[model samples]
Target: MNTPPNPAAGAASRIPEVATDASLVVPVIEEQAVVRREVVETGRVRLTKTVEEHPETLNFTLLHDEVQVERVPVNQFVADGATLPGVRYEGDTMIIPVVREVVVKRMLVVEELHITKHEVPTQESHQVVLRQEMVQVTREPLAPPTPGPPPAS
Candidate 1:
């Protein structure tokens, strides 16, 4: 899927360096950078329906049997062209599947969340004890970039 970086492009775009500071080794700063995260939900048993086997007793499960689940979607019960019935369009959440545009302009979620961040500055040399942590601060999401049509050649 990825084309190799062109050798000609690499050679042509090389930065001209100033050979003033003739240091033997350049220092590299390293810190704990969280790359991948697995959001763990504790005791997350959503539905635990158990069927006990008994010969005499048969459970009558009366669901929407006549409802066309195969041909039609639950959200599209009123037909596509027909007017949408009582749809909630509040902020962040949207209903438009194809274009994926939000129906509601703004919906506010109010919650008190604790956050923590450790900023380490450059130090000549230092030592510290290792520690474990659980809770941290949540940052506000950044705005999405402007979308445009494909560039015409």
Candidate 2:
């Protein structure tokens, strides 16, 4: 028995003839598929910040001042109608009068406290889609033409 010709195999030769008769006999066979892209929640990416307080030790120095007083007695003869000097400097110390002959010297003592700030850096990783493309596949079979009465010769 002989088999019928395959349309797909002979389609190349018949393409011109098919084109000529396409307006009358063949319904314009066209297959159209919608192309669309959707963002799907395949999974999830989450960034969480956890705040935890911990005790930290800081070491450094700060300075402030305090004053001290010392007393010394000067037993010497006073001249007729003479007064002690109002202010005098000995090295870095300043001597000032409290009253007639009683004078005091000023000096400084320092106390300390420490304050410091620090910056700590950390690293972490998370999932991301840097670049993305989508593809859709569909299969549609051609419908056979409906039988109609022969055209006028």
Residue range 32-66, candidate 1, lDDT tens digits: 76566555333322343444443343334332312
* Tens digit per residue, CA lDDT, model 2, 117-144: 2334444444443433444444454456
Candidate 1 local distance difference test against the native: 0.40
* C-alpha lDDT values of all predictions: 0.40, 0.46
On the 0 to 100 scale, the lDDT of residue 32 in model 2 is 83
Indicate the TM-score of model 1: 0.13
